[model samples]
Target: MEPDSYHRIYVERTLALIKPDAIHRSEEIEDVILKAGFAVLQNRKLQLSPEQCSDFYADQYGKYFFPNLTAFMSSGPIIALTLARSNAIAHWKSLMGPVNSTKARETHPECLRAKYGTTDLKNALHGSESFDAAEREIKFMFPNSVIEPLPSREETEEYLSKHVNPTLVRGLTELCKHKPLNPCVWLAHWLMKNCPNMPQIVVEEAEDKK
Candidate 1:
C-alpha cells in the first residue's frame, strides 16, 4: 500500500518483552496478549549479555537500581516481540499492570506481572511506553528484522500485491472502525496477514486516534 493509503488505515506499533521469569509461563503470557488483540510482528528468544543489558537500559545507567536491573535481565533468556495494533503502547502497558509489583499485586492482581513477576526489576514483561520508544527498542532488539529506509513506491506496490489481499484489507478496515482502546492482537494478526511491509510509523499513526 502507498504511504498515504496506509495513513488512511490508522496503524500503530509497540514493543513487548517476556522476561526470563516468564520463560516457563509462555502459554499464560500469550493468552493475555491474544485476548488483548495485538498482532505479533516478530518474535525471538534472546539471552542478553551484561553489556547488552546495560545498553538496552542505558537511560537508567546511573540509577540506584541499575546494577541489580542489569544483572536480573542477564539472568536468563527473554522473549522479544514486535507488536502491532491500535493504541499499542497504552494497551500493552495496561496489560502489564504497574511498574511496582506490590502495587500490581494489590491493585491489579489479574495483570501479567502480578501473576508472574517477582519484583519490580524482575517484572515478567516489559513494554515500550511510546511509539518513539517502541521504534528504538525494536531496532535495538531485532536489528536484522528492522526495515530501515522507508519502502519506495514500487516496493510498496509489490508488497501490496503479494500480501494485501482484498479480504484481509477489508477485515482490518472494519476492525479500525470498532474503536477499542487496546486492540493490539487484532491489529497484529491483520498486519501479519495483509500488510507485512507496512511501516511501523504508519501503523502507529493509524492507531493514534481514540
Candidate 2:
C-alpha cells in the first residue's frame, strides 16, 4: 500500500475518561486533546452509580483498591470522550501519563495527571490499554454509538453481492412487475419479508449449568 493509504487505514479510536477530579478543568483538558491532534467524535458527562462503575471496571473488581475506586468514580460526573486518530490508544495513554500522580509529576511533568491529579487513586483520567479494551470501554460508555471498524473493500463487495444485492434485486423485480403506486414503500416491505438475511432468533434451551 502507498504511505498515505496505509496511514489512513490505521486510524484508531480510543476511549478517554476525564475523571471527577478533572471535570472542572475539562475545557483545558479538551484544549490539550485537540492540540494533540485527536478528533473528539463524541463526549458526554455521566454520573455513574457504584454498580455501573464496578461493571465498567470489571477487570479490576477483585483488586485491593476496587471498592474505593468504584466509590470515587461514582462520587461525581465524569466526561467520557471518544477520541480518534492514528495510534490513538498509545497517544492518549502517553498524554495521560503514569497512573500515579506523583510518578507522573516526576517522569512526565507536562502530562495531564501531573498537572491536574492529586493522588495515585484519583489520577484524573483513564484510557484504554488496547484495541479490544477500547472497543469494550467505548461501548460501555456510549452504548448506542456504533463502534465497529468499517469492513475492507473486498469484504464490503462480497457482502453486497452475496446478501444485499440479491434481496434488493428481487425486491426491485417484484416492484416492477406489480407497478405499485408507492414503489419505495412496497420495496421496503418486500425486503423485510423476503430478505434471506433476516436476523436470527436464538433460543436458550437449557438453564445455566452453574
- Position 40, candidate 2: lDDT: 99
Which pairs of residues collide in model 2?
A: none
Question: What does candidate 2's lDDT look like per residue over 107-200, in tens digits?
Answer: 9999999999989999999999998899899999999977777454456556666777777778888899999999989888888888686775
TM-score attained by model 1: 0.67
The models' CA-based lDDT, in order, is 0.80, 0.89
- How far residue 157's Cα lies from its native spot in candidate 1, in Å, is 20
Instruction: State the displacement of the C-alpha of residue 51, model 1, in Å, after optimal TM-score superposition.
Output: 0.2
User: Which numbered prediction scores highest in TM-score against the true structure?
Assistant: 2
Query: What is the C-alpha RMSD, rounded to one decimal, of candidate 1?
Result: 14.7
* Regions of model 2 farther than 4 Å from truth: 1-5, 150-210
Q: Name the lDDT value of residue 43 in candidate 2.
A: 97
lDDT for model 1: 0.80
